[model samples]
Target: MGGPSREMTVMRIPLKKAKHHFGASLSRGTRPYNEDAYQAGTIDIPAFAKRRPISLTRNPKGEIKNEVTPAGSSSGDPQVFYFGVFDGHGGNECSGFLMEELHKYIEDAAKDFELESSLQIKGPVHRYIGWSGSAEVDEQMPASGSAPETTAEESLGAVKTYTPSGTESMKPPKPGSKHDGPTPGAKSRQSPLSSAPPVKQSMSVRKAEDLERELVMDWKELVGGYFRRFKPEWFSMSAGGRGHPAEQDVIAKRHYPNSAVPNEAVEGIGIETVLQYAFLRADYDFVSAQVGKRDEDPVLADRAINDDDILGHPSRGGKSIGGTKRFKGGSTCSMALVSTPTPTPFWHPAAPSTVVTAHVGDTRIILCKTATGLAVPLTSNHHPSLPEEATRLRRYAATFVTDSFGEERVSGLANTRAFGDMQSKRIGVSAEAEIRRIEVTSAEYSFMTLVSDGVSGHLSDQEIVDIIKEAQTPEQAARDVTSFATEVSADADNATTLVVRLGGWERRTEGGLGSLGTKELRDWRKAEAENPRGRM
Candidate 1:
């Protein structure tokens, strides 16, 4: 905020018997508070010998059984590389929360694959989990009760409609119109603290709260059950069931139906679904905590409630007054997951890695091709101006307006999709992520870049790629890109950059801005020389 606040992180990831380098840099640029957050690391999945099991096997009696033993530790745990960047608005709390909890949820969601076996049969399962009909099954399942569940959006009628051309604002619903809320027999979205049964709406209508509850219950049952299976002492020692009273009650009263022995197999959902699940779960937890709902899980509790740096009510000058967490803040999230290639029948040893990109809001990821320094965009920004995003926001009759700076804003938010903007939830502001997958050959791509809007807004994709290619290391690449953003933008926002070096990093062909002696390149070099270590 004052002098630039800069932070750097470097990670060494093992990929196909080789060490890969990745790093991140964050710089507070002209902002009173730096709300951007990012993370990079690895997630270990149990390695199965031949095939990875998604669901538990069933016996003749149709009762679920855990066949794997606790001591059955397998070899070759597959590690997934994870990189995420979050940009916060209104406050830093939301981004900060994501920095700590998003990856944990992703790891938990990944476990849904080998839920039972993952616990007992430890080690990385070599196979990538392909799409199964689990989502279809969940979609087809009837709502928990006779009546359908209601979402907050339903309670508040559409007051406006946003379109690619412009926004059309509508008058408030007529005094006695259908905008009043859910009809009789319809269940309302409940707070995690509420004793009311969670609203089980259709997938199309399900809110973040619903998914958050499902995640918590699933963890309590699946993981807690794992501890319970071994020993009573171990369960207690593991603190398997510690949490809010309401959560504990829910856990005690119900269990994951999937945990029950099934007559047929239930395959785990694909990685795309896992990413979506994690994004929603993390968003829900953040929103719920803002309203004072806290979980006992150490990781969840630490970020949700214990961080003193978390922003409080905006009305209270954005600082926690009297040690109480307050008000709604929002964060945009972009993440990339790199998993080992699922082997083909022929078993090609040099298969490309599968890269999954999932995100909401304006942050994005770009892949730099080694052949010609090509910038390939993996994630698209979700702004109301986009046709698809505009159509989605229109369902809630959301309004779009141009700010004084000439940027389009949905309702009052810059992003149509984001995490933790609780106030805008009713108007169809969403945390639902856009998921994409690609196979990257180490010979074709040099690296991947993940950046918050601050950097992307100031630098073109090719320019970013060229800057990273010009750097000596991932850390320097991150710093150079972010520092360059500040140099170009008069009022640069908090800029954050992450660079992931791939196998082709050393074998790149010069092209685009990287090969040109452009004025931009000269200006960047001049700025770098003058302030080699300015702020960041």
Candidate 2:
């Protein structure tokens, strides 16, 4: 007999270990605090109140991958001092994501030519929806009550097969053995082992088809709901300026819940909303300052007036400095995309060519001016009561005053308008914020600090300004504010701060005091050599 016939079998083996390496560190738990219980806490709230000329930046302890640069001063582009403090609710993920991606999104939006085109597009993009066909009913029917039975041959064919050792190939069966099966047409029939019946294998292809149809239907409903809820508000150039067209006339409106009622008003009301609005306003404000056309002759004339030369100077001959209008209170987000004007081939003193656009968000923005002494603000509160916020809050009959949130008086939340929490809007929360443009003169250099309620909640605006003012740089200012809030706040929530300082101005350097660098380095080397096992 031929040596046991050769055959091959393949087996799959799974690996025992996962192939990914995740790098992460555990953060220490925050110090506990009780809101219902009041304990005295001391912060150096007024240490920096005396005006001082200084520059600083503060970064919280972490690994940051982005470049933090001071806004530059150039003739062509307006330098922007960008800052923000993000207060987190629910979890830290949202706040962290905002810090990492907010600027990128803004920059990307700024560069999109399609955005400009979309603004000019007249009509809405109409979408056509359709449904799929349903399963057809069978035309022919089987007799009364019995289900179909499987044939013997078909049942036998469904039985599983196994190979025996020493038999490389499978054969149908032997003629008379107990384990052997007989051919259907043979003279002597041999039964299968133990006379067991064969099992039937069923393929329910129709059931699978039914499930797929249901899934498709569910998906269609989901898509429809998504579109209905998030209908896009296409861009429009006509919507520029604060209170220009007025808040009531704007097509967009916020619907509130029927149950919400205004009780005791709050102080520093709408602080978060105001800060956010201000930051966006700063962006627009600075952009307008840099690019808005003003006749050079008039600006010179205004500057030329002095105690003795008032009569000799010509009356300011140019039109008033034009800027984008302030927004009404209820508006949440704004965008403007304008084409840069072409420079005149020949210098025309009368024609000033520049393009400026402005946009605003509901929360805060940071602005830093390096040219002037630091002036701390009372608080960067953006509560609804400010004139800029009035129009936005009119629809809801909402007013910013002490006790907005029941009895809590110093609710640091400022802006009446912001993104997220649609439910709040239903309860008379307005999402509108004002946007304005203010010129930055040679005597005035300023940086903006934008933050959400998270940071503002625990610290006053002046306190924040003071902290930033004391720091050596804008980055340090931001980090210090965050750290201080984290150290002091009674609540456990997300907090963030952005500090943008103006650059291109000259200031005295600390290094100018003396040349002790070599001596310090030498001392460090000697100390390290002596210690040998030092950790530094």
Candidate 3:
């Protein structure tokens, strides 16, 4: 019996890949620290007005679930840009599904409107068919696909009654009478009545108008039902470990009518819906570029370039020292789509198009107004330090560790909010996404860096800003910042960086090697050098 039991136990052990508990890794606590630096070389170049552009990079720590979608339309009729970043936790199913379906839904809605409009202009054939006593029959057709046929009396009630005998006397003309017979050899006369002054057909005109109105109303109702049916498939939530239909209802209630929904819940549906409509109303275009060893390899670089070579060749960075891979995920995804229906009448030409970024466990949307040098942060970071996060942490009995950067726990994995890691959510560590709106002005345009916590974990925000200040181009700044982080946390896991710089405008070009004058710049540089790898 004991031998059989042992064999059964061995057989019952589950395979690692097949396990569903997303929390298994988290429950095991942090991985053993491995100190190795990954170094990639850097580029030295002068800043140019036209040379600046956005840059991105990513590295796999282990397994990651991040997806990004960027689209733009610049038809000159209405210019619009859209960008979205979805960071999935638990699994990639939700984010991946959303990336493909959201855009299609928007496009489908637009096409439905166009088709409805075209159907409104019914020509003469439509008028004749509609007038041939067919409308009454259609009205009695039991609402097309509805079940349960109507009774004969009910169907007949829908048709209008016309009694000829009561309305006008029917006088049968006598055989060979003058009214019925052709006059004997009288000059064949054309009836003056044939060209009688054109009688204005008000009834026909009114029918056409009614048809158009009905077509519009039907289209609206159909689209509304479609949205109601499909929106719930996008998300799922449970309460107290029990099945709750109300949760589905809550998400369904959030769907906007022909509008884009923001990540935030309090902002309500109207504002985001209207903003999305305006932004998507115009046409724009998008192109995604990557910078990393995998992308820059000779064979891979060839296919990444275009005829116009709008995206230059992939550039290499420092070497990867073994063990420096901070986050075990895929590369960061960044995209820029054009924003049409420009907010201003003056036409702000230098905006960053539309920027969307997603880290392995977070979602962020950023809009860059290059003309005004403003970086509007349309979403918030899912950090664990917020009040809501603190409450969640207490529920999980999770401890917090204070570092120079701020207060983080478990080497920052314990952030109150994150994208992936369903295991975390099981412990009440739910992610609360924040959406921020900041104006990016020229003064703030030095360069922008959007990175995963793998990099941010080790470096302070000011430290990153200083790196941008030191580098000549945005790409160089990204590399330098990444390099510094790797070096400092040579013992850390996967680290990644994405940098965006404003182009198409002129700025000061004087300080190359000696421009570390400002107090903010000096402080930032000092902080960066002191903690290059972000280790506290």
For each predicted model, how many residue pairs clash, with residues at least 3 apart or on different chains? 12, 84, 56
TM per candidate:
0.58, 0.33, 0.35
RMSD of each: 19.5, 37.2, 34.1
Which 10 consecutive residues of model 3 have the lowest summed lDDT? 282-291
Report the C-alpha lDDT of model 3 over 1-536, residue by residue, as the tens digit.
32332212211112122221000010101324311111111111110011111112321111011211112122222222233433332233333433433344334423322211111123332221122232322422222232332232332233222222322221323546565222110111111111101101112222322332443243234333211121111012211111111233334545757433222221111111111221221100000001111323454435433433434743343222111122222111222222211211111223222222222222222222222322233333334554544654555456667777564653345344432222333333322222222222222233344543444545544344445555655556556655665555434434445444432112312222212323343344345457747344
For TM-score, the strongest prediction is 1
Indicate which candidate wins on lDDT. Answer: 1
Query: 268-326 in candidate 1: lDDT tens per residue?
Result: 22444456667756765666556563223556445543344435532433233112445
RMSD of 1: 19.5
Q: Give the winner by lDDT: 2 or 3.
A: 3
> Against the unseen true structure, what C-alpha lDDT does each candidate score?
0.53, 0.28, 0.29
For model 2, the superposed segments whose C-alpha errors exceed 4 Å read: 1-85, 92-391, 397-415, 427-433, 441-443, 452-454, 488-493, 504-536
Error of 3 at 286 (Å): 26
Off by over 4 Å in 1: 1-20, 46-75, 113-268, 293-323, 342-351, 509-514, 517-536
TM-score of 2: 0.33
- Report model 3's TM-score to 2 decimal places: 0.35
